[model samples]
Target: MTSSIRRIPRRMPGWAKVLTAFVLVLVVLFAGVRLAVLPGLRDLFGTETQDRSGPALLKSIQDMSRYDAASGNFQVVVDLEKDAKYLPDVLHGSRTLYVGAGTVDAYVDLGRLGGNDVTVDADRTSATLRLPHARLGKPALDPDRSYAVSKQRGLLDRLGDLFSDNPNSEQAVQKLAVRHIGEAAKDSGLTARAETNTTDMLQGLLSSLGFKEVHITYRS
Candidate 1:
């Protein structure tokens, strides 16, 4: 009778151990499915979100850049809502005029007219300008057009050309910018919901001018 009782307890222990092992295996499988398999499937088959307005914005920027040099009446309308945090003061305070040929000249308020002129050469290779307190050297102007400088080989020019040549480059840049913007919004205590408002405002203004994409980098 005592031996039988001991055997019953021994059997109970074995059964309990088996049940625990089975539960552990089930838990592991459940986690694996939820964490790994589902995410993999979604990445493989999910529909990509496309920004439909990008093309129109890019076209507008290109058109603004292509203004005729003879007219001297070109205007670049910036969408403030999309890029207000970084662009508002610059756009409203400083006036950037497109010189009929290909150059861009910006004049900032210094309490007087013609106080300063920051000239970005036509080829987009170099810049020449006189700031309020700083003086810049004269750029070597191209013989064909006395007002604009010849295209120079530079790191920035090379990178810009690379992005222009590769389709993936632009997408990569957009992704990076979006990530940075998200981070900025978080750090600034701004809600992500505001992004839509900014993007919409920008789209409206850019669509009118035919700009498909505007890549902005903030400086100190």
Candidate 2:
């Protein structure tokens, strides 16, 4: 009986051995699939599910100023010598005021042209400007007169408006303004124009005013 039991142990079936080997192989593959393969696949396909809330492109450009906690204001000084003509027209005639928290008031005095004041109020999404008086040549509208207007419409309406406007007239005005401003900047001996520096300065000022986002647009 002891010898028979020993023989039974030695003669175990090959099929059973092969089955055990296959089972071990499957267990290894299953572990690899769960730990490596699945995670890689999820990362490849699920990128949009990651943290999406962040500052917008325009907002990033705007918030480059340092705030004064004591005064409760953010300030950036712009020397208008370089582009004096463009500065006044763009600021007063064009209606493009620095949009941010509290109010943005611009004071400009250019010799014979005199001084003008512009105020822009901080609306959460955009700015609301109150123009007490803006004089541009004809006192109505002039090609050389720079001005900005803000409009709000649905996406579709904005797209339509872009096409419906007189393209040639707009181009002519833009070219004239650019040429005039370039000349004025050279004459004034300004190293850099205010428009170039205002975007980021306005944003930082707005942030100091407790706004998280700011959008500034140039209008004619």
RMSD to the hidden true structure, all candidates: 24.5, 26.8
Candidates in order have lDDT scores of 0.34, 0.37
Error of 2 at 128 (Å): 7.3
Q: Best candidate, TM-score-wise? A: 2
Candidate 2 — what's its lDDT? 0.37
Candidate 2 clashes between residue pairs 3 or more apart in a chain or in different chains: 62-203, 82-185, 82-190, 93-147, 94-146, 94-147, 94-148, 148-219
Tens digits of per-residue lDDT for model 1, 14-70: 889999986876686466557656767657655788777744444343213211111
Any idea what lDDT model 1 has? 0.34
In model 1, what is the error at residue 127, expressed in angstroms? Answer: 62
RMSD of 1: 24.5
Q: Residue 213 lDDT in model 2?
A: 59
Candidate 2 differs from the real structure by a C-alpha RMSD in angstroms, to one decimal, of 26.8
